[model samples]
Target: MSSGKEPANGTSGTVRRRTSTRSVTLRDVAAHAGVSSQTVSRVLRIPDEVAPHTRARVEEAIRECGYVPNLAARNLASNRSKIVATVIPSLSASVFSETLTGLSDVLAPEGYQLLLGYTDYDDEREEALIRSLVGRRPDGIVMTGAVHRETIVAMLRTARIPVVETWDWTDTPLDVLVGFSNERAMYEMVCQLHGAGYRRPCFVGSLPAGDHRARRRLAGFRRAAAEHWPGREPRVVDASGHPLTLESGARLLDVARGAHPEADVLVFSTDIFANGALLAAARRGLRVPEDIAVTGFGDFELSRMLHPGLTTVALPNATIGREAATLLLRRMRGERPTTRTIDLGFEIRRRGSA
Candidate 1:
């Protein structure tokens, strides 16, 4: 009888060996680089400690072997996951997405990676995400917006890791804050519109229920309108329960005009809504500025591309992300910042649309 180890061809009694499908390990990298396993480990953990030539050789071997470091084991030994967790309202929005790009630009080069979580503008979801991320023992956490539930604040404080809040400013941040005053930004925009001799202004956007930023913006509009025109309540068209899209913006334009025909200007919560209104106006054979003026928050790229361009608030979205990452890095390195809050500020871009 033939042994099982015999070759399938049966030409000779030679045994066929099975190739290993196991992942490449540190020892394998060391062997490929002609160095010890400890040297490979040191090259990954502390490259400065190893010579330049040796570090280059190890890195080349790692690339050649497609070696992926075992982060779990490294985390256990160093007590640091080298991961930063970030929670934002929406990943599809350019405002938040640009901020993420800024974050990655600064953090990736520092050997840190991001773990992203989306809240869909839900407070409860945000709280749940924060709880889950904290449990993961991340080296740092970056949260969008300053307004958070008490439980979330308490959990973050107890975790004792570096926490950074971005996008919205607050005097009493949980740890560190990197954002501008949403209220003040909106307030200034209203004032600028008023200066341009546009009376009977109307606000259009989502309700201040789940979105704290939108709520603050609305408050600013009300405050400014009240101050500018005493006893005259600001007109608002609620776009709640609707996605902030051009289509929604177009529909809201018709609603706003129908509800308040006397309104001379429509100020949107975002450029997406404003752009939609502009398109809708054109389709209705209405002239801009002459028939009805339009303005928006967040100077999106499409804003400039739109006809007559969009008059909107230009927020430092990317700067907020970069600053938040830099601040988190400082805290993770056990360095205390001179100030806990960093306000990047915002600017109002007046284009032809208004």
Candidate 2:
């Protein structure tokens, strides 16, 4: 696992016990070199911070003990962290989960490991997490969303490491990027709905925060609605992210029934949200596509399993991860990847929902 520890082997004799921690610390290096911890720290932090001879001795001690510095200290010293820390919202969600799986699959061959963290959809938390991750100075930084804090953007600008934004794309990328256009894809899906004989469409999903990706999708939906309906616009039913269960789908249905009783179709940015919307529709005795059509993106597994299966746009999440990882490895190897934004294409899986 590269845990910075030596593997233990069983012995025959009764072993004398010592502290288990052994990968080398400043104290250990200092003791080995007959110096103080502060001196060793300075040397480890940077050779220029200490005398040349002392730095040489510390280096020797480090080599002898097979020591690896703490990630932060090492990063500050060498200006690069070998680990690629990926921060996402929740790992339990299929979209990010599948995307992460794709990232792992692609990076495995390139000797890069992913160090991941979660932010629970909080913008401030995400900003803080990205800041902390950046302090470590990773070789490459891969984030779930394209939008980031201004401070984070500034950090990426000077970090000299490739920051690859996945799950969505923008016109201006920090360095390298991959994945489909979230807003444009939603626009296309809306276009599909218009072509399917649906006039007024409503969006059923979480309330848009400053989440640029979600906002983009919403904007696209609005644009499509404006283009198709001319003057009449569709209503948006924004839901809470708390207690995300299938039952909550019913609430969205209630909203649809109450607010947009005249609307003919509902478009969900995510399949999970769409699933909930569909469930609510079935319970309301509304025959999908007959009474009110439902459409979704990220073609989840359940999209195909439901009765009168959901009509959705299939997003190649795994393909995105694979491509993102490939691009990252190429950048690491000084091989510049040609494309920044990869469409991966979208397919309309029309079963019965819309």
Q: Which candidate number would show the highest TM-score if scored against the true structure? A: 1
lDDT of 1 by residue, 192-223 (tens): 99999988999998974668998999989999
> lDDT per prediction?
0.88, 0.76
Q: List, residue by residue over 1-354, the lDDT tens digit for candidate 2.
A: 566442232122222222576455656656666667788778755568788888897777667655666766655676555688898876656878788888899886554679898877677888788778877766887888788788778867876778788877777888777777877888888998888788778987775464566677888898888888777756787765533456666676777668889888888767777788888787778888889888887788888999889898888878878888888888877787787666566677887988
Which parts of model 2 are misplaced by more than 4 Å? 1-80, 240-244
Best by lDDT: 1
